[model samples]
Target: MMWPSQNARRMWATVATFAAFLGGFLAYLNVEPVAVLFQGQHLQNLFRDVFPPRLAVLWERSGLWWSVVETLAMAFAGTTLGLAFALPAGLAGAANTTPHGGLRAAVRFQLSLERALSSFFILMVLLIAFGLGPFAATVTLALGTLGGFGKLFAESLERVEAAPAEALAALGASRSQQICFAVLPQAAPALITGSLYAFDINLRAAIALGIFGAGGLGAELLLAYNTLRYHDVLALALVSLVLVTAVERVSDFLRQRI
Candidate 1:
C-alpha cells in the first residue's frame, strides 16, 4: 500500500488545501462562539419564558382550527397546481422527451427563473396585488414548487431507460406516442415520489409565506411572538413539529412502497 508512488503525497496535499480553504472561509465570515449559550442564567431565563405551551388557547381562539385547515388546503392546492404545470414543462425540458434543443433550452431557462425567485419575494409582490390571504400563500408556494418539481421531473424523464424508447422508435412510433408508452411509464414512480416530496416542501413554505400577509399558522405565530405570547408560539411550534413528522413518515412509507 505504501508503494503507491506519489498518491499518498497527493492525498495529503489535497487535505491540506481543503483545510486551508475552510480556515480562510471561517476567518472571512468571522464566526464567533455564543457566550450566552455558555451562561446558565441566560439559559434558565430563556426556558423560563418559553415553558408551558398554551394548548388551551387554541380552543379559546375561535377559527384557529379553521386556520390550520386553510394552511393545509393551501399546501395541497399549491402542490396540485405546481404538478399540473410541472408535468408539461418538465417534459418539454427533458432531453429525451423534447427533440428540439432550442425548446428545451427555453423551458429550462423559464424554470430557472421560477426557481430563482423566492417565495418570500413572490408573496411580497402578490400581497400588493392580491391583498393579505391564503391565496397569496398558495400562489407563492405553487411558483416555488413549479421550478423545483419541474427540474426534478425533467431529470427523472432523462434518466429513464433508452432501450424502450429506441424500440418504440424502431416500430415507427411517434414522439408523443413513445413518451406515453415508454417514458411516462418508466418515470411514473419518480413523478409520484417527487410530487409527494414537493408537497412537504410547499407545506413548509406556506408557513413562511404567512409572514408576508398570507394567512396561516405562521401569521398566528408571528402575532403571538410580537404580542409576547410565548406559550402560544410554543404550542404552534409543537403542532408544526408533529405535522411535519407525520408527513415525513407518510413520505417514507410511500417511497419504500415505490
Candidate 2:
C-alpha cells in the first residue's frame, strides 16, 4: 500500500530501515566460505534429531555424580583457604586497629601489591614450583583472596562504629584489645558474609584454572569436551549448574541473616 501523506511516508521509511537492519542480521556476514562452517553439508538429519532426547545416552556417559563432588570440593576448599588469609590481613591492615600509622600503611601496601599481581601468572609460577594439582589452585586462591578480602576487611574496619572503640582506647586498652572488643565484634557478621562471597568467587576461578591440569571437575569436563563426548558435557553442565545454585542460595541466606 502506497502512503501519500508525508507522515505516512516517514513511517514507512522508518519501517523499511528497521526491516533492512533485521534482515542484515539474519543474513550473517560470512568471513569464510559457507561450506567451511557446516562441513559442506545441508544438514538433512533434522527430523531424526528432532525425535525424543535420549536420557540413556546422557546417563551412560555424563558422570554426573563424580563431577559434582569434584566441583564442590574445588569451590569449598579454595574459598576456605582465601578466608584464612583474609581474616588476619584485614585485621592487620586497619588504621584504627594498628598501634602505629606506619605499620598500617605497610600492611595495606602489601595487600595492594598482592591485588596488582595476576592470579594466572601466580598459578604458572607455582605450577613450575609445585606442579599442577589442587596445591597450585590453593595457592592461587589464597593470594587472590588475600588481596580482595583484605581490601574488603580494611574497608569494613574503617566503617565500623567508632564510639565504642574510642571509649575502650581511652580506658587504656591496648590496640589489639580494642579491636577484639570494639571493632571485630561489631563487624564480625559482615566480615564473615564477605568472606563467604569471596570464597564463592574463588571457587569459580579455581574451576577455570583447573583446566591446565590443576585437577578438578573442570579438568575432567575439558577432557570430556575435547573427546567430543556431548553426554559428558551435558552431565558437567547439569551438575555445575546445581552446585553453583546451591552455593549461591546458601551464601544469600547467610548474608540476609547477617
Candidate 3:
C-alpha cells in the first residue's frame, strides 16, 4: 500500500546513487570517456587496417575448411562426453534422487569447483599434461560442459513435480524405480533443453580455447592477428559469427519444440 509517488522517489534515489558511484569509480580509474571517443587518429588507423575483409580467405586459405570441421568435431565430442558423465552426476546431486545428503553435497561441491575454474585456465593446465592440440581443447570444453550442465540438470530434476514420485513411492516402488519412472520422465524436457544450451556454450568455448593454441578456427584467428593480417582476421571473425549464429538459431528452434 505504498504511494506511487514514494515508489518513484525511491527509484530515482537508487538511480542517482548508482550514477554517483559509477562516476566516482570512473574518476578513480582516470577514465576520460570524451577524450577516448574523440581519438580520431587511432580510430582511423584501426579502421583503415581492418576494413574490407578478405572474403576469399573462406576458400583461398589452405586447410581453412578443415579447421572449421575440426572445430565442429571438438564441440560435438566434448558435449557428448560431458553430458555422458553429467547425467549420473546430476542424479547423484539432485535432492530427491540423491542416495544421501553427504553424497549430494560432495557431487555439488565438485561441480562448483569445476565451474569456478575458467575453461581457459583449465586448458592451460591440461596443455601441460595432454600437450597442445584439439584434444586438450576438447577436454577443456567437456569439463566446462560437465560443470555447467550437471548443476542445471540437478536443479531441473529437483524441480520435477513431486506428486508422481510420491505416488510411485506409495505403491512400494524402490527409490531407483521411482526416480527412473517418475522423476526422469517429468524432467526429460528440461534435461534436453539444458543439453542443447550446454552444446551452444561449449561451441563458443571451443573457439576461444583454440586461440590459446588448441588448434582450430581460434588458432587461425590468433595466427592472423600475430601476422598482422587484419583483413584475414576480420574474415575469420565473420566465419565465427556465422557459425555461432547458426547454432544459436538451431538451438532456439529445438528449445521451442521441447
Candidate 4:
C-alpha cells in the first residue's frame, strides 16, 4: 500500500506515454509497411522529372528577376511598417510602460485581433480592396508581423529591470521620459531581434501570398506546379531555399551581436 518512489512513477509515466504514442501511430498508419517499397516507383519518377533543376528559368522567364526583387522589397517594407506600429503598440500594451489600465487592455485586445488573422487570410481580404499584387502581400505580412511583434515587444518591455525606471520616476521624470531613458535602452535589443525574425517569416509568407494572387515567387511557383513543370518547381524551390538560408545566416549573425 506504500506509494511508488518518484523515480518509479516517472519511469512508468514515460513508458505509458510511449505506449500511447505507438498505439496511435499504428492505428493511424492505414497503409501496409510493404507498400512503402513499391511507392518508390512513383517517387523515382518524380525525382527523374525534377532533377537538373532548370536554373535557366531565372533568366529565361520574363520578369522573374524583377519578381524576386519585388518579393524582397515587399518583405523588407512589410517588416519595417509592422515594426513602426508594433513599437508604439508594444509600449502601450506593456503593463509597466502603459499610461493606464484601459489603454493597456485596448492595446492588448487589438494585438490579439491582429494576431488571430493569418497573412493568407489577410491577403484575401486586401485583394478585394487593393486588387492582386505585391501590395496586398506586403500589407498582409505587415499586419501578421505587427500582431506577433507587438506581443513580443511588450513582453520585452515588461521584463526590463524596474529599478532604473523607478529611479527615473523618483527623479521627476515623466512616464515617456522614463521609458525613453530607462526602458527603451534595455528593450531595444529585443525589438531589433524580433523585427529581423519577423522579416524572415514575412519573406516566406509573401511567397505563399502569391498563391492567392499577391504576385511574388509563390504565384510563379504555383503556376509552375499547376502546369506540372517539375523542373521549374524544383528550380524555384532551390532559389527560395538559398534566399531563406542567406537571410537566416545574416539574421543569426546580427542577433548574436545583439
Candidate 5:
C-alpha cells in the first residue's frame, strides 16, 4: 500500500486539528443541540402561538401604516445627510483625489473608527441627548451610512481608470478640474449604486432602532411582544419582511439599470 504524500498528510493534520478544537469548544460550552431542539416544549409553544399571523392588524392598527412611512422617511433623510458629508470625505480619503497624504490618513482613520462603533449603540447615546424618537435614530443611521459609504466611495474613486486623469494632468489641468471631469465621471455609476445599497441597509437599521423607542413598526412589535401578543408580533414581522424585500427588489432593479 502506498503511504500518504507529505501534502496529503499536512491537509489531514489540519482537518484533524480543526475537528479537535471544535469538539473542545463544544464540550466546554456544554452545548447539547440535539437535546435542546427535541427535548424542549419552548419551541413547540412558540410555533403554536405565533402561527396564523394576525394580518388584520394592518388595518385595525390606525398608526401602523404611518409608522411604516416614518421608517422610510428616517432612512431617506439619513442617507441624504450621510451622502452629503461622505462625498467630501471620500474625495479627501482617496489616494488620487486627496489634497495631501496626511489628510487622507486622517480621514481613513476617522471613517474606520465610525464604522467600528455599532449604530444601535450610537442611537442609545443620542437618545440621551436628543431624547428619543426618529431624530436620534436618523442621526445614528446617518453616521453609520457616512462611515460605510465614505470608504466605499473612496475605493470606487481609487479604482477609476488612471488614463483619463493622467491625460488631464498632461494637458496642464488643475487637480480639482482633473478630478471633477476625469475621476468623478467614471466613479459616478459606482457612487449611485453604493448610495442605493446604503439606503437599503439604513432602512433595516431604522426599523431595528425603532424597537428601542425610535418610533416605527419595530416599536409596535416590541409593544406587542411585551403584552405577549404573539399573533400581532408575527404580523408585524411579516410586514417588516415585506418592506425589506420590496426595497431590496427596487435597489436591485436600479443597480441593474446603472
Candidate 6:
C-alpha cells in the first residue's frame, strides 16, 4: 500500500495522541480499575465464588414471569400515551401545519420545556404523585418520550410532503384536512418508527425504574441484591438479558417491516 501523505500522517498522529491522552486520563480516574483480570483479590474470590448455577430461581415466585409481562404492559401504555400527546402537539408546533406562527412558537416552547425536565426528576415527582408504584415509573417513561419523540415528531411534520399540503389547500381543504390527508401519510413511517424505538428504550428504562421501587422484577432484583441473595440476582440478570434480547429482536423486525 502507498504511504499516507504528510497531512494524512499528521491527522493520524493527532488522533493517536488524543486517544492515548484519553486512555491515560481514564486510567487515572480508575474507571473500572479492576477490569484487569483478578487485579489482585478479585481473582482469589473468583475461585471461591464459582458454584452450581440455580435455574429454578426463574420459577421461584412465579411472579418473575408476571412481572416481565407487567413490565411490557407498562412500556406499551407509556409509549402509546406519549405518542397520543405528541401527535397533536407536534402538528401544532409544525411551521406549515400550525394555524399561526405565534401558536407554533408556543408549541415549540412547551416542547422545549418538556425536554428540559430530567427523567430522574420526573420519576421522583411521579413517586410523590402516585407513590412508589409502577404508575410513577410509567409517567417517567412517558415524560422521556415526550422530550425525545415529541421533537422528532414535530420535525417530521415540518418536513413532510409540502406539495400535497399545498394541493389540499388549493382544493379549499381546511388546515386539519390538509394534515389528515396530506401530511400524516408522508410522515407516518418515520413517526411510527421513532415511537417504536422510544418504546423499546422505555422498556429497558421501565425495568430499571421498576427495580428502583417502581414495582416490578426490578424491585425483586433490588431486594435480592440487598439481601446478598446472589443466586436470585443471577436469575434476575439472566431474565433481564432475555427480555432485552426479545425487545431487540422485536425492534429489528419492526425496522425491517416498516
Question: CA RMSD for every model?
Answer: 3.3, 7.3, 2.0, 3.4, 2.5, 3.1
- lDDT head-to-head 1 vs 2, winner: 1
Off by over 4 Å in 5: 1-16, 27-30
Model 4: what TM-score?
A: 0.86
Error of 5 at 28 (Å): 4.5
Report the candidate with higher lDDT, 2 versus 3: 3
Model 6 alpha-carbon drift over 4 Å, by segment:
1-12, 19-38, 43-53, 254-258
Question: Candidate 4 has which clashing residue pairs, if any?
Answer: none
Per-residue CA lDDT of candidate 5, range 1-258, in tens?
Answer: 545797789899999999899888988999876788899987989899999899999999899999999999999999999999999999999999999999999999999989999777898899999986789988988999899999999999999999999999999999999999999999999999999999999999888988877888788889999999899999999999999999999999989988
How do the residues 1-258 of candidate 4 rate in per-residue lDDT, one tens digit apiece?
Answer: 645697789899999999888867866986445566585586788789999799899889998878888888989999998889999999999999898999999999999999897767778889889986677788888888889999999999999999999999999999899999999999988888888899899888777777677887877898999999989999999988988889889999989987
lDDT of 2 at 157: 85
* Pairs of residues at least 3 apart in sequence or in different chains that clash in candidate 2: none
- For each candidate in turn, the TM-score is 0.86, 0.72, 0.92, 0.86, 0.92, 0.84
How does each model score on lDDT? 0.86, 0.74, 0.92, 0.87, 0.92, 0.81
Q: Where is model 4 more than 4 Å wrong at Cα?
A: 1-40, 256-258
Winner on lDDT (3 vs 4)? 3
- Candidate with the larger TM-score of 4 and 5: 5
**What digit string (tens of lDDT, one per residue) describes model 6 on residues 1-258?**
645797799899999999899889988988765466646677666435533345687877767788888888888888888888888888888887778899989878888887898677778778998976678887777777776787888899888868998998999999889889999999999997898788788888877887667777777788878887766777787888888888989898988898
Among these predictions, the greatest lDDT belongs to 5
User: Model 1 TM-score?
Assistant: 0.86
Q: Residue 12 of model 3: what lDDT?
A: 99
* Native-to-model Cα distance after best TM-score fit, residue 177 in candidate 3, in Å: 0.8
Q: How many backbone clashes does candidate 1 have?
A: 0
The positional error of residue 219 in candidate 4, measured at the CA in angstroms, is 1.4
On TM-score, the stronger of 1 and 5 is 5
